[model samples]
Target chain A: MGQKGSKVQITENDRAILQLKRSRDEIHKFTRRTDLLISSERLKLKEMIKENPTKCKSDPRVRFLLKRIHYQDHLLQQALEQLINLENLVSTLEFKLVETQFIKGLERGNQILKKLNKEFENVDELMDDVQMQIAYQEEVDEVLAHSIVGVNDFETEIDKELDQMEREINPQQQIEMPSVDKLPDLKQRPIASSERKEQGKKEGTEAPVLA
Target chain B: MSNQSELPPIYSFPPLYTRQPNGLIRRQQINSWIEIILQYCISQKCWRMTAEGMPVGEPDVTKQSIFNNSSIQRVVPQVFVDEIWSQMCEEGKALGVQDGKRDSSQFYILWRNLDSWASLILQWFESSGSLNQVITIYELSQGDGTADWEFHGMPEALVAHCLKPLCQRNRATLIKDERGIAVATKVV
Candidate 1:
């Protein structure tokens, strides 16, 4: 069954390429493990020698472990070669896949362009019609502008009246008023005795009424 | 140096050897034991420890084990030891090495959690400009490249465990052998 609605469709070639890459990774892992084992085995040999220098030199286990380490090292080299081959294979397959996809994409794009060109065969004529319509609209807008009354002239008259009022108010405001300036000083002055006498008289008259 | 000089003053307290009858006091006692275990492990750079207080992979740290205070002639009871390990596991300060193993006989001490360890390694990698480089698990812990690093000489297993978070986040990939043992890692 095919994968429906999936953005990336995995073909058999992709799976084969993936398998090659996985095998390459597996080989790399094996070599690394062997390398670590060799180091560990060497360490163990040193420890063994330290524990008993005389007995260790003649120990069969040491010889066996060394042989095993050597064999693993050789296997690692072989695995490395195999890994290189696998990597080359995977890269080649990947390149072929990419090239195929790119060519397919170009074919699809060319087909679409051809369809678009067929659809746009009358584009120049349509553009000419659009230009004529735009010109007609512009002519209509010009006529409408000419037929409208001059509202700007009325706005200018109002602006001129406002400016005249501002000019008149400016001079009036600039004119100094001696009386107004002296009024506050006059108010601060003490009340005259005549005014106090009047105030007392008024209070005396009100007192009799209250009685 | 003598182990007594390295021990905290509370280790000499005889009451620490016995399990407390009171629930509240027992909880405090277990907490103290957990602190001691963590501190002792950190000081000794001990990664694995048995329930009997033997430091695995570190034969030299036998004298520095925290379970016994020879001068005081007291050893923590097995029950209290189990309680301490249980509390430690619950607190995420330690983890059992073997899955589905309930005995807590052997466990790894985590002075810092895996996330912290992962970040620390990432920081080191960034500082050293070793990003996108394939490094062996042993080389990271025991190789000359990491001799000056704080996590130098750490057990490979713990280093692998610490790298799990990075792997899960796709910041690193672990390359394993045919036996499924991770031998090297590539961090980006």
Candidate 2:
């Protein structure tokens, strides 16, 4: 999608022409870069054509040979350009496929996002129910606190009545019971797992296994 | 006895038409022409060689006072000269004939001699019309698109050897191509 250059090979002749145009050094190099599999001593006629052009031209063998050499150089240059173009196109297509794959990954991420949003809504509803339960538990605790205060007053009045009756009944009814001031307040020490295990052992009970 | 006379001292001779590929023979052949052309250039005070006509079919080199080898004055063909130059360039020995349709086929062999060429190269460097700066060896051999002194079809080594005296005077330097052709550079 971006501004990419066409990756086609220009031409062997074109490359050589460009080389000739650009630097004399490269032209000199390219002119000598003959890959033709000509036998060393066998290039006699070809060499003659290149050397004594006037004399070699009349010879039919030399003419055909020169054409073949020129044709070979041309074909090789063409093939090389085509290969380069194909390679460039392949890499460009691969990059496009990678972009499509990335888009698919983004789509999957969006699906995951929707599922997470639904889970969050369910959590919000559960939290609301827990808040209502906490409020109901607070009301029950308030009523229990009021009942305990009333019970404590009733127990104090009964003690006062029992004290008057005992005073009136003389030494024959002297009842002996421990007062509330003698009992220990609720102890809130942290119990370790080890202490719990020891208590279960004293009670002759094994710790239950979790499923 | 008058009729005998040893058949007027008969002699069998070869025309030397086929240029001797021998080291000594080729040198003698080339030297003989160099001697002729050097004298001609000096006599006429010709500064540059022009390979103007059809190099392969040239007939009278000395008559036109040009770079034609097949001159009625000489035995080698203009094509032979081209062949020699092409071989030399292909062999990486500059001064030989070159090949190709361009400036590579016909060569300009200075009748002015190598010494004069050395002097001319130095003079070319001194000239104001040309941007004759000390150029790279590569520039002298295969320049991008400029057709100057190098446009004359000749071997690079020949060019370098012709400029040797200039090189010795520290006025020029021999620049070698990685592929081994000689390029000349002015010391200035």
Candidate 3:
């Protein structure tokens, strides 16, 4: 009783549970109606007495209504107690249903786990194969490494050549070299611009000797 | 009735009793009436009112009824009362009780709308941990369980009205009796 493709299965137990709940609801509705009737009847009786105290007190219908109200009150109380019990039963049944489903789910899970475990029974052997392959790879790596002599030397030579080429391509390297030696001299002298230019001309002529 | 003294000062004003001629002033006047009606109902805890501007349960026209300002010797005319009710209905602050009737004799004074009332009921259910529990409508409104609640003592019809939104949204289910009266509801 669901969508076109998805039909919900309603078993006898489900129908029983539904019947129980429906009875419980009926009991609840009965108690509520009884409560309303009792109160309203009481109010009517009170109003009747107020309107005509002597005649109402003597009225047989009033007595009958009072008796009926009392009987309904008793019935209401019994129904309420029954409702409580029914509700408890329904909740317990629902909880048991949930627990049953849960246990069934766990059983399914257990079966799947057992099947998976069976499939993985040779896990240790597989691990041994992997370990053997890893060892073989390590041995091959070591043999290759031993056969690769002069590779480090060639790499170092290439690095040295790269450094030299980088220095040759970068004009900032030449400027930085002289600046390191000239910084102390300039800091010590603090030469003015004009005197610094004259000193620079003299230094340019004496640059070869200093080098 | 005892809270009559707590009514606003405008209740005693004579002009409020008369429908103003000017459209803007008349609109404002109707608005003032709406506010007064809402405030007076809240203060008196009155839920339903007749078109004549008298609370439903009170049998006779009492001096304390909002329509009649006894001290001022003025009563709101029927036309003005109808106007106010229409405005209140438009604003979702009141509901006509009779089906297929434009000017129903009685209407619910919804100082709070049904949606808000639905939320309030839901909040109460959550706070009381009554979710998935069956509770009689009578108990929800008048039983000791809801003795201290704001909606306590609310009429059963109003309670049912408030639950409509919840029922539509699948938040609750209303169980009816053989007579097709909703006697209980289960909120989930």
Candidate 4:
């Protein structure tokens, strides 16, 4: 009957187990009732034999009583067999029900675990995206910090670099004024007029400080 | 017009301010926002909006609160705001500056367009027996006779554009002063 394979572990302390136990108690009650009835009939037959041992078999009333006792014994044996079958059926059904319930719980747990795994993956991807964005923003800030220098400091730095370049290029032609004025417009030109502009700015700064 | 004192219930939902990333959901959100904006404009008699889709009482008024829902403490991002404004303009629900570079941020919310406003003004002129008479733009907008009209407080620039179609059809003549400003129009 594949009985061992059908055995399901019932771990849950719930109503089905309780109901199965209750039915077993009812079956015990039925057995007890049948046992009492059969014993009483046997006792009656014994009494009849004791009272008239020689004629008990030949006596019609005794024979009728004996026949009734035999029928009751047969009925009791059949009831016991039926009760044993019912007990086996009930226990197997109970095992099967528990097995189905356990399987259902396992399947539900597996589905929830899979769903959680998917959600975790989504969260991980989102975190990576946010981290990438933060890294990009920091890089942009670094570039901006490098490019956006204070105007006064930037001008003075340019002035110093231009003075060095001018000294290296030509020492005597420094007095050329018109070309110096136009030097600001050309991209690749060595700084020339910025020296004068820097002097003007220095004067402006000192005036403001003095005022 | 519906009363302007109360805003729609969804105005308080914080998610509405966030640009939804999902395609179908974002389209639905945009449609609802457009409806709410139009309804709010109609209620408040607002005609101008900024690049950020904020309703303004006058073109000069800055920092409107339609895009900023203080109750929920959420501000629609400027990029999304600009998108909504451009969409409205594309749908002919608003008019923008002809020159793309100059103040494209400003828009005229055409809840009722220039054409409809022009027709309403012409109807008023017909009923009031003011046809064939030159009325200044100021008189058409704020004159005592126009006090109860829907276009009473409309801008003269919009009025002139609306009158252009009429002038083209010889239904009206636009007169400008030495400053080249359209001063008045005479409807025939």
Candidate 5:
């Protein structure tokens, strides 16, 4: 349900209305697919938790292969800006510029705008980054939450795929994840466990927008 | 990295899901909306969306699952229609959205951006070589055998809006139809 409370009446030049309708529609599709992706990612993370019990080392494949390493948010913001800029450009065209040779310039600019618009056509790539981050984070959180019952499955091969996905969001870097059973020996397992729990909570919220 | 504020104002608007207001912009928005569907609807291509929720007054089923009372309490609550409409409207995209319906005059631009569309029309005009020839405004509006070009489905008001510029260069003229519709003749 939308804001049924407000008596706000949406009225404007027909074309502007059309543009809003359109962007929403496209975004709706984007969000819809995003929902499905996030769902599957949730399933994967849940399964990993169920399979692993004690702090045996998470499958490097699982931990390192997570999506959403970094810059994906940048792209979403970019694409969104691109469309908005296009919208503003169009609105300005409607409002200003009466015939001149400049129409040709406008035409050329239109091509650029069109090309930018095209980038939005397939936004699933953006979703992939967001989902990966969430999925990996979920696994991390769940692992920390349960406090080691046994084998945590993290695979390095899957890490390869995740590396590609993460590259789009963040730079590709090889990270070493100790086996679930191999907790870092910096301190006692129990003390380290408590500290990790705190760290996990902090990282959970700070998930960077991959762009 | 783009500042979140630097992005289109559409981002913050909660009611982007609401419908449009009037004129050429509205229809263009609708056509764009139609275009946007090509990406989603992988299953059977759900092209025609009415903005009304799924049949039985439920929100998108997936959204329903995610928004629980705890999450609802944490973040501000937004209903599907209201949120979509409000976001777009607040960001200045919405117009004429009412209780359960959007104004027929209002449309969402989903697919091609309007400026590109203007260029598209201009290109069609150039390619067709009918620039100077008289064209009943109706041909450009939604009618029989139209929609051949992206320009089809354009509102007469929008056609006139575009022509206003063309006419300044003496490249086009907007005369009257017997029925009071605009008849434009763009000179190549």
Candidate 6:
């Protein structure tokens, strides 16, 4: 008999919860529809009043219109209040439901701890694997360091060769005079005959020896 | 006049109420104002405007003047308004008072010139078989059949002026009673 009574109590609680959910949905829909209607109507009324304030106020219907707006606002406020209360009721009910789930969760706490310990063991194995990979990376780094030092020495040798080449090129550039025959035709035309004769003799003496 | 809602969006612009200082901008502003006035007059069937480009009242609609954008609290100066009127006169879009009056504050806005209005009246007469049928000047201007006509409510003097072109063309006969009142006309 007590079991039957408890079953009835549970069903009553579920029915109350269902009623609350339905009321909440109704309130939500009502609020949405009313909000849209109220805002648009408010805008239109405001514009009408603004367009002709005296006329709007003097009209006998304005009082009734204002009253209707006030009533709508009151309804909206009441609906919002009901909505909040229903939401609170639902949250409290959910928390009460979670309380039982929490107690059930405690029953399996030791098994959860055992699973966590197994996960820690896996983490230790992963750590060891990571250490092995790190040691391999250190060996690779040492080989790379040795190769890099060799490459650095090779680079210095090439730089030294380039320096010697530049030194040889500088003196040869100083000794080398552009040949009159190879000079542009515009430059040759501007030269006097005496200067050309001097240039020819200098070229004949220096050119064959350099060759 | 018809409702003021037919005004262009720029009609509410405050700058249009002030004549631009630059010559080219002023000219363009004048042209825009002229276009607005022409459109407004034509749409409302307004025949006359004050020098300030406001519609002359037959049956008044509103106190709001076209030259003033009251919402913006700006008004085109009367001098500038008169300049626009003179330009309209130059374009033959408006007729000035003829008697060299000092205060010629009123102008007739001619959406169609007096001659065209005259021809239209003549055509109405022809189509309606009222040709050679003498009718009082009042009947011609405000008769039942002419209610839907554009020349309806036209001043008797202006109607006579319009009919002068028709008379010269021998399409109309002006009849004056013994009292020198132009009592009626017969379109031939």
Q: Pick the candidate with the highest TM-score.
A: 3
Ranking by TM-score: 3, 1, 6, 4, 2, 5
lDDT of 5 by residue, A189-209 (tens): 789788999998777777664
Clashes of 6: 0
lDDT of all the models against the reference? Answer: 0.76, 0.50, 0.80, 0.70, 0.47, 0.73
Number of backbone clashes in candidate 3: 0
lDDT of 1 by residue, A97-144 (tens): 679889999999999999999999999999999999999999999888
Evaluated on chain B only, what are the TM-scores of all the candidate structures, in order?
0.91, 0.39, 0.91, 0.82, 0.41, 0.83
True contacts kept of each: 0.00, 0.04, 0.00, 0.00, 0.00, 0.00
Model 2 over residues A1-211: C-alpha lDDT tens digits?
2323333233333333222323434334343344433333237655776787787768878777777766757755765565456445534644665687799999999999999887787787799899999999999999999999999999999999999898887856558777878655545334555687789786664434321
Model 2 residue A47 lDDT score: 73
- Regarding TM-score, does 1 or 5 come out ahead? 1
Model 3 off-target regions past 4 Å? A1-73, A97-211, B1-6, B57-73, B98-102, B130-147, B153-188
Q: Identify the leading candidate in terms of DockQ.
A: 3
The DockQ of each candidate is: 0.02, 0.02, 0.03, 0.00, 0.01, 0.00
- What would the C-alpha RMSD of candidate 3 be, to one decimal place? 18.5
Deviation from truth (RMSD, Å), model 6:
36.3
lDDT of 2 by residue, B56-130 (tens): 212332344233333223344666555444443343322323432224534444554466766665665566322
Which interface RMSD values do the candidates have, in the order shown? Answer: 11.2, 18.3, 8.1, 47.5, 17.9, 47.8
lDDT of 4 by residue, A38-147 (tens): 68877887898899899888888777877876776777677678657766865576567669889999999999999988878778779999999999999999888877
Compared with the true structure, what per-residue lDDT tens digits does model 3 show for residues B82-102?
Answer: 888898988888888774144
Candidate 1 regions with alpha-carbon error over 4 angstroms:
A1-211, B63-65, B100-104
| lDDT tens digits, residue span B7-111, model 5 | 233333333333455555555544343322323322221212334411111234222211122322322233434344434433333323222134322323223
Across residues B1-188, which tens digit of lDDT does each residue of candidate 4 receive? 12325567777778999999998888777776777787777766777666776665654443555778766678888877777766776776777745322238777767766668778888988998767555667667655578888887776666777777676556777776578877667776
Per-model TM values vs. the true structure:
0.48, 0.27, 0.55, 0.42, 0.25, 0.43
